[model samples]
Target: VGHLAVQIARARGAYVVATVSPGKLDFLRELGADEVIDYTKGDFTDKVRDIDLVLDPMGGDHAQRSLKVLRRGGVLVSLLDVGDNTRTQAGARDIRVERMSVVPDREGLVELARLIDANKLAVHVAKSFPLDQAGAAHAFLATKPIGKVVLSL
Candidate 1:
């Protein structure tokens, strides 16, 4: 999820900083993340401030922590469920908080396909698990990404 975000954001001309565990730092840097934070070593909120935007796949309590890194009027878009308190506080800072879910739509799908065809975007699949081992796929995701994990039928 984050790998896709990094690629698209870079293509749009934004400098991206990826928050990742230590071992994956080099991989994310290679993917065009200008700066990589090792969450295992320190708190990103403490290390970073005045960010323009955040594409957070980590939901829940992380939403609030990410808010601290945003510049005023910046946006934090989450792919996971965030608690209500995070939304309320964002309003105070003039920051925008939105929870996003991918809706299957033909136009959007076609647009993404076009990007792929144009060579402006790509998908990186890290590992595939058998359909029966969906649990293992989920477990692999908890570790830092190589890219998307797939369920191989």
Candidate 2:
């Protein structure tokens, strides 16, 4: 997610600004974000003027609007949508738009495994029902779950 990108960017000595839900302000702060904009508060385009890069996965109009915050010499990488006429015009010459997809990689998987092994990452398992109770668990999942639900043996 963008949170991970922000962390990686900061680690590489880039001045990073991130936008997240208002409820996640504390979480973003803990992740060492320099600026945290709450998307629910107002239009991020209005306040976040001039940015170097925009990493967008949540597309539709949301991705289109984010182009407004891009500086003349900036980059916008979208994971979930295509760059329409609007994105092209907004970008112009200096702006670069890349339609990118994050593919699964062994190196990334290895790093993830290391994080899990070190306990640096936590997996939230919401429910673990017996195999015989899978139907009940599936029913519970219909309501939406915060984490993984396992059918244990």
Candidate 3:
């Protein structure tokens, strides 16, 4: 999700700041992230500020820190739970906090397909496993590969 978010934001002409582990810095840069931070080294809030929107896949304390970098009236969209304190802080700062969940929509999928057909979007597949190896694929996913893991029939 984070990887695709970076690409989608860039496609929309956003100046993207992406945080990843040390090994994935170059990967994010290749994905057109304007700034890439190694989250393992230190806090990303130390390096980024005054952003318009923050797309956070890692919630909890990371979500709280994300709020500090957003400009007033900016949006923080989290794919996971960002506790009450984060919401309170966002309200205080005039920032909007949104929790997002995936909902299937045919229209959205069609648009995504159009983007792919036009070479405006790319899907990063880190690994693929045969149907017989579904368990192995799940285990590999647990290792948190850099991109999507596909189960091939």
**Candidates 1 and 2: which is better by TM-score?**
1
lDDT of the candidates, in the order given: 0.86, 0.75, 0.90
Off by over 4 Å in 1: 130-145
Better of 1 and 2 by lDDT: 1
lDDT of 1 by residue, 1-153 (tens): 777788778877898888997777888788789999999988999988899998888887898899999999999999887888999999999999888888889997887787788776788888989999999889898985677888987
Model 3 TM-score is: 0.93
Cα lDDT of model 2 by residue, 1-153, tens digit: 665666566655777788887666776677668999998988889888789888887777777787888888788788876557747766574778777876889997887677667544445566899999999999988865545678988
Best by lDDT: 3
The weakest ten consecutive residues by lDDT in model 2 span 115-124
Residue 47 in model 3: lDDT:
93
How badly does each model clash, as a count of residue pairs? 0, 0, 0
Report the C-alpha lDDT of model 3 over 52-114, residue by residue, as the tens digit: 999988899989999989999999999999999999999999999998987879998987888
After TM-score superposition, the amount by which residue 25's alpha carbon in candidate 1 deviates from its true location, in angstroms, is 1.1
- State the lDDT at 69 in candidate 1: 94
**Predicted structure 1: clash tally:** 0
Candidate 2 residue runs with Cα over 4 Å from true position: 91-93, 105-153
